[model samples]
Target: MAAIPKSTGMQGGAMAEEAADELTLLAERHLVQPWPMSGSIGAEARGRIEGGEGIYVTDAAGRRLIDGPAGMWCVNAGHRRRELAEVMAAQAMELSYNSPWYTTNAPAALLSGRLAGHAPDGLDHVFYTTGGSSAVETALRFMQFANNVKGRGEKKLIVSRQGAYHGSTYLSASLNGRPRDQDWMDGAGEQVVKLTCPNPFRRPEGVAAVAFCDYLVAEFKDVIETVGAERIGAFVAEPVMASGGVIVPPDGYLRRIRELCRQNDILFIADEVVTAFGRLGHVFASQEVFGLDPDMITFAKGVTSGYFPLGGVMIAGRLLEELRRSNHSEAMFAHGLTYSSHPVGCAVALKNLDLLEDGLLEHARSISGHFQSSLKALEELPLVGEVRGMGLMACVECVADRVSNNPLTLDLEVGKRIDNHCQELGLLVRPLINMCVMSPPLTISTSQIDDMAAILRRGIELTMDDLVREGLWRG
Candidate 1:
């Protein structure tokens, strides 16, 4: 590997401007950003975020904006946490890295015990990975491997849901159900089955919320029957579909689905990559918030509060026991990551857990209601179709009108317009086509929540006015 570049100490005014310009030029020339359009594939200069503190980040131009999506829904303890940084430095100095293939580290061993205490019952063992994608990939692969070892190799089909976002790796991305995600990408479609997104706001024309829940459950039943449960290995779902516009499922939907999976002997995998680690005011929301007893749970993002890349799969102890007693007990699972149980990442995570247990988790729980209600009020806006969320995560979806709740055309880019206006007004927004997702740091105060809501309100109003003036939308 090439030697790391030394910082040049560029600070203030012209120096900052010149540094920002050079960075942008370098990115445009050589950087390949995630989820770029084909038109600007390798030559895209997006925004430049220079520094972050607490619930805000400073742009390259020195403008501080509220971190709306909490750095992609991580940063539970917020940015620039001295303790987390200190822990990483101390651990690196003490023992930077250790191979998981043979040697085990202290931090990793300790974190596993702490996490198991917080995880649901039966989920007592963990398999560490590099991040959410790899975590999910590991879970699916484990399911396949376990079944193959048990003489059920045909049970390899994976079931997922619409509007779910798992990861970017080949197998994990294959499980993604978003419309635009697979437009230009090829996946293992034959190995996966998708169910309807249980979004109450977008339920069928005449179905009520209760009926919608039943419909979703019934559909899963039909899928199991039609596909034959013997061929299905696992059913993967997010507790709250994070990137799918924060789509919260209908009441009792997840529980019913869980029951079906249990009855059919299919492994239920809760992909809590975004919801875990205090985002929903819990270390694990499966049993705490959703009443789920999944066979495996995949998590990342907030594990190290985005300070380090770390993720893991919480597996049921009984499952491992079953494997141990099987005839193929001598066979290897044959999967591992170089950074698995990384000493520095685990050290950071241990400290991050300390912060959460001390007070951050309780703080998140206390303010979640206010955060949710504040954004829920945005439904009154003419451009906002609906504002739905749970805990501190929410989405403001813009539509053509209230009567139909139909999305605006792609050309409008309503969400992006709102985000631009919000940025100008000193707030950042995660624009998802026609929706603005807000998931600020868990440390956000009630006063800051008010300011964020006010800015978002004004941003929508401005966008609505722009649309009306442009004759693209009539309100």
Candidate 2:
């Protein structure tokens, strides 16, 4: 990977001039920003953030914008954490990197133990990775290892839901079900199965929540019968699907799916890359919020609060015991990342966790009511088809015809327009096609949330005005 360019954090004349030109030059020569590389090269890179403090970031031009999506849903502790920065520097100076293969580092071991203590009782072991993608890839590979060692080589298919964004790695991305995630990209199609997303808004229009959940469960049962349970290895899902526009599953859906996995002898992998680490007001949302006891739980993002690239999987004690008891003797799960168990990353994560547990978790919980209520009020907009979320993660979806769920001419670019307006109105928005998703820093205050919501309302109103002038929307 290219070295990360250090921010100058300048807002003045000469410094700003250098920063602006450097931003474009960096975009021109290097830095393929994810998802937007589809456009022309050096296409005016927007929002060159120079610095961040609390819930707001200062652009190169010194405009402070409310960080609406918490730096791609990672900066749970918010940005510019002095303590976390100090930890990174101190650990780097003491012990930079030790291979996870042969040598064990103190920071990594301590982080593993600390994380285990935070997780459920049986998830006692930890495997570190560079980010959420690698963490998921590690878990999926572990499942494959387990199935093969047990003499069930045919049980290799992974089941994932539509509209779920697992990761960007080849194997992890294969499990992604979001729109455009796999359009021109190749995935391990033969090894994966896709399922319908349990999104209430996208479910059959009038289907009740309970009935919708039952239907989802029945679909899984039917699929298993068709494929023969022995051929399926593990079922992976996000408790509340992030990046698929924060598509929260129906009530009773997650637990029911967990039950199905148990009955079918399939390992359930909970992908909590977003919900974990106080995003949902908890260290982990698996058993606490969803009542799920997954066979494996993969986490990243909030773990290091976006300070360092770090992620890991919590291994269930039962899975290890099962491997130990399997007949394939001396089998080895030979997989390790160069950055796995990285000392500096681990040390930063430990301090990040301290900040989270200190007061941010409870603060997230306290502010959730205001966060949800403020955004939910946007449902009154003519263009807003629905507004849904839990905790700090939420989405505002727009539609030309709410009944049909049609984007009309707006299609995907609707999100871009609202984003532009929001940026101008002193807030940054994570635009998902026609949907605006927000997962601000857990440290965000109620007043900041109100500010975010107000900017969002104005942004939507601006979009409405544009559509009316264009003669596209009746509003």
RMSD of each: 2.2, 2.6
Q: Against the true structure, candidate 1 has what lDDT?
A: 0.91
Best by lDDT: 1
Q: What do the candidate models score in CA lDDT, each in turn?
A: 0.91, 0.89
Q: How close is candidate 1 to the true structure, as a TM-score?
A: 0.97
CA error at residue 336 for candidate 1, angstroms = 0.8
- Model 1, position 103: C-alpha lDDT score: 100
Which candidate number would show the highest TM-score if scored against the true structure?
A: 1
Model 2 scores worst on lDDT over the 10 consecutive residues at 400-409
What is the per-residue lDDT of model 2 for residues 204-308, given as tens digits with 9 covering 90 to 100? 767786699888898999999999999999999989999998888888888988998999999999999999999899999998998888888999999999999
In model 1, pairs of residues that clash are none
Q: Per-residue CA lDDT of candidate 1, range 231-264, in tens?
A: 9999999999999989998778889999999999
Error of 2 at 306 (Å): 0.4
User: Which residue runs does candidate 1 get wrong by more than 4 Å?
Assistant: 1-8, 401-412
**Model 2 error, position 107 (Å):** 1.3
